[model samples]
Target: MQSIKNGLVFIAVFIILATSCSKVEDTVIHHPKDPNTTYFPMAIGNYWIYHEFTLEPGGEVPTGKIDSTYIEKDTLINGNLYFVYKSSLSLQWEMIMRDSSSYLVNYLGEIFFHAKSIGDTIFREVNLNPLGDTIFAQYRIMHDGPDQIQLPAGVFSVLDATNVQLFPKAVSGPKERIMNNFYAKDVGLVFRNYFLYGKQHALKLARYHIEK
Candidate 1:
């Protein structure tokens, strides 16, 4: 009888250990970023604030414009749900969405965002509705692995979404522009470095919240 009781206790302990191990494994197996979005998180209530400035390369960067951007909410446009953001430009809206494979940035309703892995490249010429304005964008996945970046708010392990745009002189503001956007897992854009003509501007996150 004594030996049988000991055997039962051992089985019970083994079962408990197995259950604990399974739970740990489940945690490890879960994805790091939100399942719906990666480079740019589109959850409701997620927002980013930026300090826009103008700087000459290897020179002083005097603060110019202080810009703040945030996602207002999710709205269904033309039967498709899109995360809308506040913008100064007079367009339909600055929106973002996710498909099965990747995140898409709708610059005034244009599907211009692309690239997910290293060595990936996306090139497109998107047209702004009714204005006859055209935008040529070329993007290459410079880094898709683990990387750390420091912002005005904090440090982060970010996935970089780097791109360059060839804009017409009418819209390019007398120079071309490039953007190196840094995004954290589960968080939206945390940092961005914008280069136009002979000036550089940084958009650093002052604060952010990833909606649960």
Candidate 2:
């Protein structure tokens, strides 16, 4: 009887261990595949505050300002759901959608950013002056790998996206425009540099909140 009880106990212990191991294996198998999605997290209540500065033409002296951007709510457009984006700097609201493939798309079907994309990806081309129609711009997004960037919100690994003028050629005087946006995993945008005409506008992350 003593030996039988010991054997039963051993079987019970083995069953418990097997169950635990199975659970661990399941967790590993179900782990998230696209971590890049965290680079541009989209959820209601997620917000970022920026310290904005504008530099004078051909100079590094910057006049500072502050602005914030946040996700207000979710709305359906064309049978697809998108988050409504708002900013303290502008009254205009934008509709943003994210797919499982890590692409951020606007309501107009424009690709804002692709987190997994490499090299140069042309997402938008627009005529700056529609009436003029001759002054055109091309917006490109790319991921040049990862780098460590430091800000008021601490240091984080970030991805980069750049936008530049393709037509009319970029010059030093007027009509020159270039923009760079940096995004951190699970943290959204951390820094931005927008140079237009002869002035430079920069934004650095001041603080942020991500609602999981």
Candidate 3:
């Protein structure tokens, strides 16, 4: 009886996903400084290979998605220079991010750009997309300096930052989200982990090409 009920639930979710909206939220990352000098380098021709891991709603195992993201070029928006990072997840799907500051902007949302350091806690501005909304983003430096961590991509000393997002009514039973980013100086992001909908998802830098 329990197995039958679970099967029905799975089928229902699959149907919903198959017919879901074609438009996805845009994610924007803004960085005004030279990517070459920042924790993430933004030289054209530079590329990062990322492995995405998504878990089943109630499972601990993960499924992989995505392959590589290349820093193709830079564009001017509102007279502001922004680096473009494009991720071709599949033949039919793509995700792009505009790096302005440490903040990223996408069709999904935007994070306010600013300087950050260790032990700094701040409430920054965020302009999200899809619904085209603005809100405050609260961030904290969970760890700074050198954090030696290992990922499938490689091992590196990283600068870690954490953010907590609250949702009034999220999926099923979740109401909050926690995201942590591990950035490798020069190489950019090494790994990222987040908990959403009571499930854990992650991304790791598998390989990279940085231009001189």
Find the candidate with the highest TM-score and give its number. 2
Error of 3 at 158 (Å): 0.8
* Tens-place lDDT digits, model 1, residues 79-191: 67777665433244354554324746453443333335545554445546466655443443444523455555565666555565555635425334455655666556665
How much is the lDDT of residue 139 in candidate 2?
A: 67
- Which model, 1 or 2, shows the larger lDDT? 2
lDDT of 2 by residue, 118-142 (tens): 5768486767664665566766767
Residue runs of model 3 more than 4 Å from their true location after superposition: 1-37, 54-62, 90-115, 122-142, 168-172, 195-198
Stretches of candidate 1 above 4 Å error?
1-37, 57-65, 88-93, 96-100, 107-115, 126-137, 140-142, 166-177, 196-198
Off by over 4 Å in 2: 1-36, 55-62, 126-134, 167-176, 196-198
Query: Deviation in angstroms for 30 in model 3?
Result: 26
Kindly list the per-residue Cα lDDT of model 3 for residues 1-212, writing each as its tens digit: 01111211110000000111122222222333232455766677777665666546554354555455666577676666666665454334333455555654543444422235455544344446577643333344444523355555555666665565644433554344455666776677666665544445666666666688
Score each candidate by Cα lDDT.
0.48, 0.57, 0.50
The whole-model C-alpha lDDT of candidate 2 against the native structure comes to: 0.57
- Which of the two, 2 or 3, has more TM-score? 2
Candidate 2 colliding pairs: 38-186
Q: How high is each candidate's TM-score?
A: 0.59, 0.69, 0.58
